[model samples]
Structure formats: structure tokens, C-alpha cells
Target: MKKDIEIPKVEDISVAVVKEWNDEKTEEVFNVYLINLQNKQIQNTLVTSKGYGENQSTGEKINTSVLRHFIGDLDAKDFAKIEPIIEEVFGLNNEYWVSFFQNNQMYDKKFIFLPETICDENMINVPLLNKKGVVI
Candidate 1:
């Protein structure tokens, strides 16, 4: 006789872009953070980030930054901030791609930034699950 077994998959991982303003709030910088929402820990993680600027009329894409980092272990309900220097003028047709791995499994999320998101809001909450979760 054969017995059936179940396997578990890694989930509950997310990313965020944090912004900081200067004394007069004239200049700002950004940081990317990897959030683990699960109760357990994930090991051997790698996070990669890239930015793109798209042309609405011509349909052309431009590369902004190609960043990669290795996060050894991530605790439960914790987060890891990857790189701390993001300088980009996000227009209406700009987007970001952030990919990562957890225990040999790969997960990724993308964020499309509009002019209103940056100009109106102070902190941009980028969710790690899907497009919507990361773009808010």
C-alpha cells in the first residue's frame, strides 16, 4: 500500500519602498524592504531590484537601476531592507521589478508608480504578494 503525503510551500513574503525627506522636505531618498509575514522563518534569500521608464507613445522602456543582495535569514513577522539609495524621478509610465528567493523558492513583485503616488503621498507601501499589494 502507498500513502499520500503533503508538501508545504513558502509564502507570506513581501517588499516595500521606504522614503525619507530632508529637513525642509525638499529632497527625498528611498529604501527597499523585504517583509516576511509568516510565523516561520525563511532562509537563504536573495533580493533583486530594477527600475524601468516606459514611453507612452513610443512604447520604449528604459533601465534605471539593477540591484541585487543576499539576505541570509528572515525571521517571522520581520523584514529586511535591501539597499538604501534609490534616486529616481518616477513618472506616469514608470515601474519597478523586485524579485527574491526563500528556501530555494523564488518569488517576485512589481510596482507601477504614477505621478500622483509620489507627489501626493509621503510613504509608498509596496506589498510583496502581487502587483496591487506592492503598488499602493
Candidate 2:
């Protein structure tokens, strides 16, 4: 008898958070990366990101910073990175929204950085969404 096997799904794109440091390692900057993991290129890509947090006294969300980019084409297995202002997106209560288009299809993904994830690691891998609203 043959046993059934499960195949894992592969993602075409990925988003990640990285830290850039100066020579002394004391100065650092936070960055976001959009990577194309597929074999083919993605065309007419646009990326917009925003960071927000809930108010301490009011329970209302507030915007911290906004970032946007447009790329004609992103080559296969390549990536684009944006370095946001460190103070805008580094707070413990902050969350981010990253939206982009690949091959004319839109993908929007939200990421929340837990204290442990960013504090202990130099790089943190975030999630990406596909056209069907599925995490890729």
C-alpha cells in the first residue's frame, strides 16, 4: 500500500523587515523588503506602506508614517527595499500595511511586529497576500 503525501504550497512573493546598521553598530535603520520569489518578472508594480498605532488615551488608531513606490518591473528572484524613518515605525504598538500589485493583480498584507520578533532578531520575515486574499 502507498501512503498519501502532502505537498506544501509555494509563495511567489515575500515581505520582510530588516535592520541596517552603521559601522559601529550603534546607529540603525528599519527597512521593509518586497521580494519576488517567482521565476518570472512582475510588471507595473506599486507599493504603498503605512504605519499606525492606537492612541494611549483614546483607543483610536493614528497614522505614524506613509511610504510609497512604483516599479516598472521587478526581476525574477529580486527584491526592493524601503527604509522608513526609524522613529515612525519602531514603537511597540505599531502595525504596518503593505500593498502592492504584481502582474496587474493587487496584494495587500498587514504586519504587526511583536516585541520579541524585532527586539531579538536582525531580520523578521513577514507575510504576503495573493489576489485571493490568501497568505502566500
**Candidate 1 collision pairs:** 14-128, 127-133, 127-134
Residues 5-123, candidate 1: write the lDDT tens digits: 43344356655556656458798766556778888777776766555566667977777666668887888887776766434445543344445556666655555555435543455
Query: RMSDs, each prediction?
Result: 6.9, 9.7
Q: lDDT score of model 1?
A: 0.58
Off by over 4 Å in 1: 1-10, 21-28, 55-60, 85-89, 92-119, 122-136
Model 2 C-alpha lDDT per residue in residues 48-128, reported as the tens digit of each score: 666556656787877755566775577887877644535444554434454555655655555555433454334434433
**Where does model 2 exceed 4 Å of error?**
1-10, 22-26, 57-60, 85-88, 92-117, 121-136
Q: In every candidate, how many clashes are there? A: 3, 0
| TM-score (C-alpha, index-matched) for candidate 2 | 0.58
Model 2 local distance difference test score: 0.55
